[model samples]
Target: MTANRVLYLLGSAAPPVLNIAGVIERAQAADWDVCLGLTPTAARWLDDELPALEELTGHPVRSQYKLPREPDVWPPADVAVVAPATFNTINQWALGITDKFVVGFVAEAIGKGIPIVTMPCVNAAYVRHTQFDASIATLRVMGVHVLYGDGGFVPNEPGQGRPNGYPWHLALDAATSALTRRDAGRE
Candidate 1:
């Protein structure tokens, strides 16, 4: 576990984001103090379940930046996992665009030396876009553990996404490995 054991479990508006509750539960089972954050679209998708998610995590499900002078809602994170990271999120994050709360936090986290794990849920069609590969490479070069392609999330054909088959465990395992690596570096 990380020194803080605080996990910022951020998700984007992919189909896999719908099963986030179960992922949160699994993270909790691993003894992580999970803080949930969502992209705006993802937040809207889970609007009705936001309260329950907040209750489950014992922290707010923040999708927007807090106003200046407002107290921060979630605890500081020891590690961050961006699963089902949408195509937009991946590109924006790599380009240092932090308009959205979830992307903002993770982008800043990189400079703060917070270990991060991200798995993109982009469809094969979207992966063909020119920016996608560059973005993915940029993130990896920044020391983010990107679980993509083989040994991680492989994009399915467009319109053929299987929400349940997004390989949640790989992202969780990558998070665990990231924390472990951080701890080892300290020793």
Candidate 2:
């Protein structure tokens, strides 16, 4: 069977952001051809690991928007997962903002009918923002699978989250299930 091409988008969250290699490994084990994309802050955070990440995924790690005439490097995504999806990314994406490469790719993916799954790594304090709930609601309405709350990533109290506690596997599993559901629907 052909592997599913997954765009593994990252945001600037503490735990999962630092464990990107593990995320890639999990995705690959599940038969996904994973491409890594990062928010600008996330890119900066993972600066020293860029080379290793590129080698891991066999594609350039994209953080910024490329020049208009530049050729696209990664394969077309069969699905996209934004693990450690930060509050900023979730809000901006809900508002259709694409200033960053990761956001832009996901925005376009939605229109392209690619199944997009997001597991937000936000704190309870930030979740109180007026836009946060509305943003998630909008994304869910747009058919983005937001793995938050009870069945997914639960909000931790501010400054209490441990790197080991982040649910990286849940994000991958949600992506896989979404792809399966999409395929089953086509059949």
Candidate 3:
């Protein structure tokens, strides 16, 4: 199979970031060219990891607004995944507020009608918050896929039910399923 171009959007949450690098590695092995989108808040966790990501993906990580003087080369993304999406970022994107580079890219993707999957990493409290709920609802109405978060096995806790974490492999499956469904409808 040809490598699919996937854009990996990293949020500022801990568990999500914890698995991203490994996910990138897996994607690379599968021949997918992964593009990294790091939020400004996420940059705090990216010390040596940023360059390592570039090395792993063979494409520069795009976290800032400034592009190179000359047009830099990058593979067109086949799909985009925002793993560990923050409540603020999700709300902002859903409400059309692209204040930062990462959110801006996601906004542009939505505008262009590209395939986007957001795996949110939110506390149990915020997940039930009104604004968060509304934002996700608006996003779904606008055709964005929100991977439902749930903590498997555990009945209740803060940040319990997320589609990410140790079950990172499931993410690829979830993304594939969404893309397949989207493409099938188009056909």
lDDT of each: 0.94, 0.86, 0.69
- TM per model? 0.97, 0.94, 0.81
Candidate 3: regions farther than 4 A off:
1-4, 67-73, 150-167, 182-187
Is 1 or 3 the stronger prediction by TM-score?
1
**lDDT tens string, model 1, 6-75?**
8999999999999999999999989899999999999999999999999989999999999999998878
Task: Tell me the tens digit of each residue's lDDT in model 3 across 21-88.
Answer: 78887867766677777787676577568787778777777767765685745666666777667778
Better of 2 and 3 by lDDT: 2
lDDT of 2 at 114: 94
Ordered list by lDDT, greatest first: 1, 2, 3
Q: Candidate 1: where is the Cα deviation over 4 Å?
A: 1-4
- Candidate 2 backbone overlaps, count: 0
CA lDDT, candidate 2, residue 181? 96
Candidate 2 segments whose C-alpha is farther than 4 A from its true place: 1-4
As for model 3, its CA RMSD to the true structure in angstroms is 3.4
